[model samples]
Target: MTTPDTQSCTACQDLERGREQAAAVRDRSKVTDFHVLIARHRARHPAADEAVNVMREQGPRT
Candidate 1:
């Protein structure tokens, strides 16, 4: 099965766009900006659900 990012979906494109925006403003990104980026990324890429869910279950990495 194709992953969301590899599927060339709109959301995936949006995520890439977001990343670009973040990179463009890297020095200005605040805590809230990071949170927003993560939230948007998760919202746009449901196909990542399996991996994300598994990670959530596994807890934070050291």
Candidate 2:
């Protein structure tokens, strides 16, 4: 059963993966594309997006 939490987690994981791959190849265009996608996702799910933005601002946890 795919719940909202799972769906949100998957979206976050996919975006993070895309970001890492883009960075690995130093592909500016792809990175920009991912940024666009992320923005759309944030618009669609502002609450979930807030959690992500907070984590991003705080940096990775140790």
Candidate 3:
């Protein structure tokens, strides 16, 4: 995933799905705006900058 902010345009025909996830994630945002990206990163325990950096160095998300 390229981050929620990048994917917020959404990828679904179901308006309900978009609205639900959108509404639920509204408060988990960050100052720089990479909410979904950060979320995916954290899912892999990459809250540490080094991990994120390493992942990036090797190219992330295939």
Would you estimate the TM-scores of all the predictions? 0.34, 0.58, 0.22
| Cα RMSD, each candidate | 8.8, 11.6, 10.8
Clash counts per candidate, in order, are: 0, 0, 2
Give the residue spans of candidate 3 off by over 4 A: 1-33, 46-62
lDDT per residue, candidate 3, 1-62, as tens digits?
Answer: 64433333333223335445665777333322444554554466423456668878999556
- The best candidate by lDDT is 2
Best by TM-score: 2
Q: Considering only N, C-alpha and C atoms within 3 Å, which residue pairs clash in candidate 1?
A: none
Distance from true location, Cα of 38 in model 2, Å: 0.6
Q: For model 1, how does the per-residue alpha-carbon lDDT over 1-62 read when each residue is reduced to its tens digit?
A: 64544465665566556767767777455535655765777675565656668788889776
Off by over 4 Å in 1: 1-7, 27-62
Ranking by TM-score: 2, 1, 3
What's the lDDT for candidate 2? Answer: 0.76
- Give the Cα error of residue 13 in candidate 3, in Å: 34
Candidate 2 per-residue lDDT, tens place, 12-48, comes to 6698689789989999999899988877875666567
Output the lDDT of residue 58, model 1. 87
**Candidate 2 to truth, TM:** 0.58
Supply the TM-score for candidate 1. Answer: 0.34
39: Cα error in model 1, Å: 11
